[model samples]
Target: MQRIALLFLILGLNCIAAGAAEHSTACGSMQLAYYELGTLYYRHADGSYTGIDKDVVEEVAKRSGCKFDTVLESRVRIWTQLKNNTLDMSVSGIPTPEREKFAEFIPYFSTRNYILLHRDMPVHGLSMAGFLNDANLKVAVIKSFKHGPKFDEWLEKLWAQKRVYEASDIDSLLRLFLARRVDAIIALPTVWQPLLKKEEINKQVHLFDWAPQDSIVHGLIVSKERVSKARRDLLRKAIYSMADDGTLEQIFTRHMGSKLAQELRYDGPRF
Candidate 1:
């Protein structure tokens, strides 16, 4: 009785609000995968996962009385599996119309996507367009990432102009930029800055005047085909409860500080 009460309190709901599923039921048996966001869910030497997103997911599970067999996989595989109904949930996803067809979202936080300029460029006040138009300079992006509709259109023009360098993931993109192989990179500091080792490089990089997507969000995306509507609603309510109780704020602020949290506009379920 005491343990159930504690869970209910943490979840910000009475268990009676939504009849609890058994520990071995469909939603409880679902598989969860964490995308390879370095700080978000990197494997420790001991093979355990820990990060802001992981913490949020753990709390949601406790509140909703759900359990998952967690795995770490590539973002591409995670999405493919979710579409094919082979995977149950992913904690790191940016919602899009295409994704909406396959997954139901419970957005927990937002992120900023900005262009990083190599400080060696003698020009000040250079914008993303100016950098892209310069034939000698190359811009880096993760292949097939939708930085937002506008950015995607601009990237198409880049393809015709032969000014784009494609990387398979953020790690490779960062390497190409840091090695002086690319003049600029489009990325999120919230996700990339923590992976950087050299404080000097961070100082050396400057933000381009144009932000491609200033307010792209990150969230839990559960498979619409695999999880029932009831389960999805239960999870969504649990996530919103965390935000309402300021648990989401604490988790993000601990990793990103108050300023970035405010700047990125950490929010829940705008959809």
Candidate 2:
């Protein structure tokens, strides 16, 4: 009878394992949107995606026992599709009240934005207000990117003065900046480090932290319409678990160095 009981217990554990596997499979594959943002997510020569964001998503899927299908899209389009319920998930998203209505955000990382300028530009020590007042100096920015309220306000004023260039995406923005089409552009370290690795590009560009107090938390955003509440919570919990386990920091550290990784993980005054 004891042997029989042991056999029954073994069978019960096996059944539990099978049930968990089935549940994981039942979760289905989610559509994850990625964009070309520095070391966050980008395509490679082999036509594959790899970066800090990609690693985070992959690890979350592993912990949650879910699958994800990632596709490339611009930051603007990613938000639009999330609102339309056409996209299931995305990483590196900043949460706002409007976005929170259509999606649930899981905060994982923090970073600040800066004004990248040509090394030769005479805008050193100039505040954002001063930069704005210089009518001859034109600026470019990635469309639909939020660089804190002050930077956004400066952009608005620049726009009103017809001194702003709106690039559809990061690559185009970098090109415009590099080609000297725009006098300055706003970028985060994660978005510029990988793209500006070339010696010449590095020499041509410099950054001004217009708003030192402006830090923003970014993370996974799940569509409330397409993803069930339970599933969304599951993903969020997985990400939080990753943060607790130091997986998120390690991923960022692997892509960027330790200094920037620490800042991205716990910068002061997060927006």
Give the winner by lDDT. 2
lDDT string for model 1 (1-271, tens) is 9999888796766554454445325456668998766556665689776777788888888888778788888888888899888999998588888999999888887765677777778573266566666778878998757676556676788889888999988889988988989887887656565744468667778765365445677779999889999888778878888888888788777766776656544554344
TM-score of each: 0.83, 0.90
Model 2 residue pairs with clashes: none
Local distance difference test, candidate 2: 0.83
If candidate 1 were superposed on the true structure by all CA atoms, what would the RMSD be? 5.9
Q: Candidate 1: lDDT over CA atoms?
A: 0.75
Candidate 2 structure, TM-score to reference: 0.90
- What overall lDDT goes with each candidate model? 0.75, 0.83
